[model samples]
Target chain A: MLTAIREKVLAGKRISDEDAMYLFASDDIFTLGALASHVAYRKNGRKAFFIRNRHVNPTNICVNRCKFCAFSRSQGQEGAFELTIDDIIGKLGKGQATKAKGMGKSRSPRSVHVSPHGFSEVHIVGGLHPDWPFEHYRNMLSAIRKRFPKLHIKAFTAVEIDYFSRISGRSLEDVLRALKQSGLGSMPGGGAEIFREEIRNRLCPEKIPGERWLEVMETAHRVGIRTNATMLYGHVEDLADRVDHLSRLRRLQDRTKGFQAFIPLAYHPKNTEIEGSYTSGIDDLKTMAVSRIFLDNFDHVKAYWIMLGEKISQLALLFGADDIDGTIIEEKITHSAGGLSGEKLTAGQLVNLIQKAGKVAVERDSFYKTVRVYP
Target chain B: MITQEDNSRISRKEALSLFKNADLLGLGMWADMARKGLHPEEICTFVVDRNINYTNVCINKCTFCAFWRDADDADAYLLDRETIFGKIEEAIAMGGTQILLQGGLHPNLDISFYVDLLRSVKERFDINVHGFSPPEICYIADASDLTIRETLSILKSAGLDSIPGGGAEILSDRVREVLSPKKIKSSRWLEVMEAAHRLGMRTTATMMFGSIETPEDIITHLDAIRQLQDRTGGFTAFIPWTFQPGNTELEETGRVERTKGRTARTSKLRVQSPATAVEYLRVLAISRIYLDNVDNIQASWVTQGLKTAQVALRFGANDFGSTMIEENVVAAAGVSYAVSTNDIIGAIRTAGFVPAQRDTHYNLLRFF
Candidate 1:
């Protein structure tokens, strides 16, 4: 069966779901990687891309308690805290002069530009705080955008967007439009824990359904906002479920051509309610390679080094992964879920890892614009 | 003939076999190993230069060129000395160390025209004059009724520092006959380069692939450069660029010949597909392994964009070619990828190497 699949691949035919299932079940990791590497080279040669961005999760309090999440806390939990707008501004390098300017803050004359960290984008996602109004979210984005007018703000996931719509008594489009007006540049690919209904029900029952997530993504695409697609694999999902998830993403890309990348998040099983071990490195590599093979129309495949360790991320370069997310200044979501990768990597360190993998490293912005290509 | 072994010089047959059946990743790894072995100081280099096409008027209307114009065309242009000097001044202001002076094979330009141009530029600027490919030199020699050596000597005395390898499209005469028959014969191009090398001038070797050339023909091209470099050791780098078919005579005539009532046989001569990125990297790696005598392999960012050119560093390229302050020929071919000095430095750093600015003779100017 593997031979048949390889033959089809070499003959320039698309691999069927059965072929993907067979590949998933195969024990020969080297052959699977080689097959996927052939496709990877066909798409992009020996180049792997990274970005220089900061991760800013604004709040950690949520209403729904998903089984696989360890980052959220109840309203008064010890570690649960929402950053005040001033706190967020302070983090962005505006000192205490503007801290007294209450909640009704207009874009002030851009205060002392402190740390030019060379960040091209800011990745913003957080828990759905029950008390804060939608206006708080809007103001947060607006303030951040005003502070760093040049940085691309990839804020909010589909799940958060859906929650905001329900809270604000508006349609999804209105909520997205309001956020866009507040300077939302794009959407992140999170809260998409395996698209299988059964698995989604078992893992994150109170979260948005898989269908609603797709609908929100389609609506975002219709409004000319591109987003990255993701699948949280290595959990209870079967091989068939994984293949189906990739196939659906591929079809969506066919219609919209808006997905910039497909990231297969490795499910870490340390602090969540799930009672199993972490997925092995073999499973992670195979998942990444299979996603690259399946999502042919998708322009990029990202191996979030925060989920997969630096070593595995380097190996993923040869296994059909072209992007190893970025510096991610302070990543909390992955670390809270028992991901042991560091909270940050220097641009120099990331470039070294990519170069050590014998691939050229390119630093990109959040929108996949080439910041630089390190030859 | 070179010997084929694990520790000896690679033979032509072994190199050809690598082109045919070597594993792509393994071949890339070996080529990169060879690059690191040759350039042990972890640095990638580029020159800040402008491709100054002095004129676009040409008599030999090669089918692959979109930058040429007839002498009588309304839009035809020949830059005057003032404009040329102004461009050089701008390039110097932008920290350019060299000017790649090339133009079409103009019908009536005598040797004195080139010598005077070289003299005026040298008199005004303290930059390197890397001018004239072999075909252009041949045209000038024929027009002036001088031998190739006399032509190169005269140009050298007039401040022509080096030569560019533009006309060696493919060293296989069979492919050259179909691709650029009117330009120059393969042997004549090699002869001109040999004459330049004998005059103690350094030159670069280039191969414009992805045309109607076979893998065997590509190997033959690399062999020609390798043998020449073995004899003269004057070739500084090897650059391989894809033949962009957009806005070319090939695309224009091949697509509309039938509409113009030409026979179907004429359209059959078209190159149907542009070479894909995978093909580009594969051949690029193979060229690095085959052209062992050439010290540098340059990535063509003008033909392949920044991303693939970045990837070329891993596939055995050690040079970013140039910052290309001003380029007209490849832009005329309808493929334009521009990069600044900072972009080149950033790309080189991202590729895990220090970036250095160099002169036309591969002399290190500065490291960024």
Candidate 2:
């Protein structure tokens, strides 16, 4: 079964759903990784990417209160707080000033394409605040764009966009377009937890349904807003559930060709209602390799270092991951769920990790444009 | 004249070269081929056993070991006969067929203490007592003024079944001199295994890499094991596990050096980074390819976790090693991956192999 899949992959043909399932269940991880690496090399030759970005989670007060989310808090709950637009900009401004000084000394002058704020992207995703108006999110994006004109502001998930549409009584396209006009460059892949309706419901009952999330993404794609796709695995999901999720994403990508990358989020079991352990390195690498091999239309697969820790993310490069996400100034969602990786990584450190893995470290913007390549 | 057998085997130079330059997945393919040649069936094996640490008090305080304690340490303990019996009884009730009976090398305990410990367990329950690693045996023999052969004869009569491959971190004396100066040298450890093999006792071989040793040291360890296995075909398996640097003195020294803003090279004790999964799989596959004389290669889920262990099945490991009803050594290092017997079986089946229950000698007892 695996050999046939390998042949298809080698012959530049797309593998079927059954083939992806077999690769997931197969113990031949080395071969799977090798095949995935072959495909990844064809797409990206010896180049791995990392972005100099900051993750600005504006609020944790969410109305959905999904069972698997340890990062969300109810309104007025203890530890529940919302960051105003000023607060978000203040954080990003301070972080950028400090990082710019560090980058000036370490980064090569030729390779360091320092933005006015030192970082090329600012990743913004937060809970759906119960009280905040949809205009508040739009204003937040516009404010960040005003402060740092050069920064690529990649904000909001499909679920958040869906919430925005509901709260504003607007259609999905209207909300996405409004945000885009307010400086939303792209969307981060989240809230697409599992496309299998049964598992998705059990994992996050109050969250938007799988179909709604897909609809929201499809709407965003049609509006010319490119986004990444994600599947949360290792929590109340099986191989078939994962295969179903990937098949749905692949189908959507075939139609829209809007997914810039596929990021497989490893479910962290800390502080969450989900009762399970962390995903093993074997499973993490296998997921990366499988996503890269299966998502033929997607140009990149990101090993989100915030979830995979430093070492496994480096190994994921060989397992078909060509992007390590970025130097996330601070990450909250995974940490709230007992994420063991450091909250932030320096740009120099990110380059070192990719280089040590025997790859050409390419600094990328939010849309994965090569800003600078560190050979 | 070169024979087909010699051509089939890789030399120390070739092994070292592979360690230095071989592509990880390429090495894995070679290893998977090697594994298929040995284990043609779609079967992987494991043992349902408990690691009964009779004592934690030791004199040889190796830096890499977090399980040892001083004789007077507040937490140090020596299990009594009844306590040992109770644990073995619990193990048997849980369908455990063997007990990995090992402990620290106490300076006070003589050969009689070990003999009685084995005899008492064998008298009450019919179980395989895979007891006494080479370090413990060497310590016991030296303390009792007996030869390694004499010590083996005494323990065999009392019910010692076989030896485990603990305390063989790396066979290079240069590594041993730095990692554990007080423990026996590489030759003495091999001598104990040789004596046990001569007595018709099958043992296992292990290598704990990812410490300060270079690629040369790893090949040296593999070569030593291969040479010994050639003389005595008593090794049932070769298990290569990464050194877990959690709560151990080694990690502490590294931390202290980093805090002082000094590079690792400036200090006499170079702090070792924990081995990544890539290095673990590379060494594991190479072990399978290099030790062609050895029949089985066991994966260390106890350190690498179950997922990597599942991957190890195709990387030349034919066994899941053990269910480990109880394990303390690696736990002391702050890395304890607890999985039940059913979990091992499930993982094997999920990895697309038949999970079979095996005894100490690799003889199949049952299949799931």
Candidate 3:
């Protein structure tokens, strides 16, 4: 029944709620893959996408002690530190240093993977600095834009915005407007852990509550910023939680086609108060495929290898994912938590991976712009 | 070569049929019935080493996890090198051969941290430093500002033995989006894996299923692993585990009211259940039966415990997984499934199969 419903849905047929449930719960993993694959083929075709962006997590400082975080620095600790605005700009300015160093230039000298297409977007996210107010972000965004106006900037998670609004004593709308005028392109889909509050109360402790997280995203969509959605898996969540996470994203997308993609974050349980076995590789794949099946309203599903590791990320392509994210020249987020994937990728390397997975690789911008097509 | 040609034109239905009735080829009744071909001893083996992820103070607070420390959290920590050194030093003393050392994407650490650790382990003791998944590799490459090849080279020079294939969920982007909105994607993951294989690092392929995927998607994951194996023969074994939902963000997202009777809907465990013996059978049988390019399919007695793991053997599984000695990840998910080498031998023997100890690559450790 679920298989038939999946076939009907993929054939441009509308499926009921019961049907959706059956489709997601089917025992046949291949059937899941096939339905998700068909949907992927219809939406994005054979094109796999990545981008040439730099992750600008300038400060690892944060006040929230969300249980799911393996990254972030306290106000002052052994390695606790913050990137000065100059330091932040200096990092982004390395796009030029990147050029000078030959990041994209095949014969260039810089040691990172330089894509054929140069950096197209700058991912601007940082821990919500307890001291820095909304204006601080304004100044930061202004400085970044003043320096690299051409680069589209996608910054701030829902949690950050919620915090920013409270700090600035304004509404989310006012804050979003101010940030946008200052050149905020879109939002990053962080803070939407599992939508179930029971887990949220226990795990996240202090994130924007599940509803507020969606409220922010839906609000952002209303204001015209296409954001992405995400679900952290493999630890402390049930399949229903997984389904509900997708269901929320799907419903929101139904109202405001704002989510450009979905990402499955694999939980790596290292260095936290909550100690447990991490999600197995099998669990990760199941999450990825099910996300694809449930999130029919979303356009693209990304398999971020930075967390999933490489082999499973590659395997994700067959399950339902289409975009492989970008080659971040220098990423700051993963390292603080003991990240293993070095913070950059090149066009050549990206091409090889997509091809190796039997797909075409393309570089994309923040708004899902086609920057370079390696296929 | 001929099989490749055949596979090129094989229909999905034909491939699906293998999930049901394909011959397991090497280790079970069919291997005995047919003229003896590939010997089990010759095939690469999988290990039972405990994956000791000592820290979760990751800079990469990816969206899919719920088990990491907020840098400011009182619970955040980093293990003293002594504890780590002791962890491995003891594992080796207890007949363990490898250590899978993967941490969250951390920041501020440099090459020296990893190199020093690798060197200390290599010089003081002789063990395979099968640590650092590709995501970790990506982090290393970014921090040192070296190409992945360059970082891998430095690690190799510093006595890095091999790579542990972890963090690979599904390679598909559609799946990746809902899971982790901010990490590396399918392409980069594969790129790093391929680069490692090219750089002479042996890796394993794994799939974490049941929480949010389909059976066909499961096949796709296996197929992806098989393709890479065909190309590099770098993967030593294939491992499949069910999702364990405990304190993750995904768990907090949605819920449905539960009812006692098995009516229209029933509340179920989040990850795939190991108790579904038939499901495990089909998956195990299909893995051994279909992943023609792969050599060993590990029995996840760790996830399934010993009994189902024993059942997996007849379902085409050959090797019993870890003596783990010590495991932190699965234990976090509320599973206390642990077994000693002697217990494993007894289980395998009880299941009517020979028990043997093997190395990281399935080579017999002088036969049991």
Candidate 4:
């Protein structure tokens, strides 16, 4: 069963949904990893991507309290708070200074800083505050843009975009264009937790449906704003649901070609209403490998270190993941839900992780453009 | 012309170089080839056993061990004969065929204590007693003023079936001096294994890497196992696991001090971060490729978890190790992954191998 799929992948042919399910079910994990590695190599060629990025959550006071989300809190909740534009900018500035100092001390003489701030990306995502206006999000982007013009602002999920459109009484296209004009370079993949409606309804009842999330992404891509896609696995969804989600994303990418990467977010089962344990290492690697093999149109598959932890994320590089996401200075979502990995990884540590896995570490920008390739 | 068999037996220098410079997936493929050459059938084996720690009180306060306790520590315990027998009885109820009886080196418990424990367990349970690692045996011998052979022979007569590969953490004296100053030295570990083999008792060997050991130290550990296995041909398996430094003293201090220039006390070897899954796979593959004489390479799901253990199938591990009805050593270090017999079977079957239940000696008893 795997041999036929292997032949198709090696020959640069697309695999069927059934073939992907077979790969997922089959016990040949090593071959699945090799196949994924082959496909990854064909696209990226031994170059593993990481970005010096900072994740800033503007608020935790979310209107939609998703079952699986330990990050979101109701308005006026004790732990719920929002970040002002100046507060976000101040955080980024302070983070940059601390990172620059650390990098200056530990970075080898051969590896030079690609960005002066020690990072090229600021990843912003947060809850759908009930009172915050669309102008608030637009102002936040423009303020960060005005402060650091060189820093690429890859912000917001499609769910947030959908919320902005509804809250402002505008269309999806108008909302996306407004954010882009406010200096949003790209979108981080979130909110597309799962495409199957049955699981989606149970997981995040008030959040936008998977179709709406895709619509927002397609709208963003059509407006010339490239974004990444994500699927939250190891929860209630089964193999078919996962494959269906990938198929939908691949179909949309075929039309828009907008998803720069596909990230399989491992469901961390802590402080959440969902009753589950952490996804086993096999499930994590198999998801990465299958995503690489099935989502052939997507240029990259990221092993998000925050959810997968450092060790499994490193192993995911060999299991068909070409990107380990980024040096997320402060990741609030996963951490709020009991993330096991450290909040931030130094650029040196990131390089060491990739290089020790026997691959070249390529520092990338928000769009995965090469910033620096460490030898 | 070099034959394929000769090529399979990698030299120590070659093994070290490969460990230093091999690509992760490439090394895995090579190890998979070696695994296929040994176990051509699509079958992976696991033993259903319970690790009954007779006592946690130990005089050898090894720095890396979280399972050891001082004689007066609040949680220190010595299991009674009834408890041990009852545990074995429960294990036999679950179709468990072996009892992994191992514990710390207690100063109070002499040879008579061990002999009686073995005899009592044997008298009750009709099961294989895979008891006593090299360190425990050496301790018993030293406490009883007996030789290693004599100690092992006495234990065997009391129905001790085999020796598990524990306490052989990085078979390098430099590492032992820093990580476990009070534990037996590397030579003594090997000597005990050799003595047990000479007495016609088959045993398993292990190496706990990913601590303070260097690449050279890892290769040295593997080579030592390979050399000993060649001589004795009694090592049924070689299990390599990462050192989980969670609750141990090693994690608290976060540095291994290595004395330099005889009198200099300032120099320190910075402790490395825990081994990543990639490093674990790399070393596992290397162990399988280098240790050609050893038949089984056990994947450590207890440390790496089930998924990585599944991936280990292609990394040259033909054995999924024991069901581990109860494991406290790694758990003491704050990392515990529990798996049932069905879970192991399901994992192996999904990983594309026929899962078989085996005895302590790696003999297949039943196929799932």
Best by TM-score: 2
Candidate 2: regions farther than 4 A off:
A1-31, A51-97, A100-102, A106-123, A139-153, A181-183, A194-215, A218-224, A233-257, A266-287, A305-315, A326-365, A369-375, B1-7, B252-266
- RMSD (CA, Å), each prediction: 17.7, 5.2, 19.5, 5.3
| DockQ of the candidate models in sequence | 0.01, 0.26, 0.03, 0.36
A132-175 per-residue lDDT for model 2 (tens digits): 99999889988888988888888899999998999999999899
- In model 2 chain B, which range of ten residues has the least summed lDDT? B257-266
Write one digit per residue (lDDT tens) for candidate 1, span B1-368: 22236676677777778877765566666777778788978788999998899999987766677777877778789999999999999999999999999999888789999999999999999999999999999999999999999999999999999999998989998887666668889889899998899999999989998878888899888888888888999899999988888766566344332122233433544754455555676788888887778899998878876545666776789999989998898887767655678867876775567899998978898999
* Worst 10-residue lDDT window, candidate 1 chain B: B254-263
Q: CA shift at B203, candidate 4, in angstroms?
A: 2.1
Best by DockQ: 4
Clashes of 4: 4
TM-score of chain B of each: 0.95, 0.94, 0.82, 0.94
Residue A19 error for model 3, in Å? 5.0
Q: Rank candidates, TM-score, best first.
A: 2, 4, 1, 3
After TM-score superposition, what is the CA distance of residue A351 in candidate 1 from its true location, in Å? 32
Q: What is the C-alpha lDDT profile of model 3 across B156-215, one tens digit per residue?
A: 889887787777766666666555545667777778878888888888877766456666
Q: lDDT score, residue A1, model 3?
A: 79
TM-score of chain A of 1: 0.92
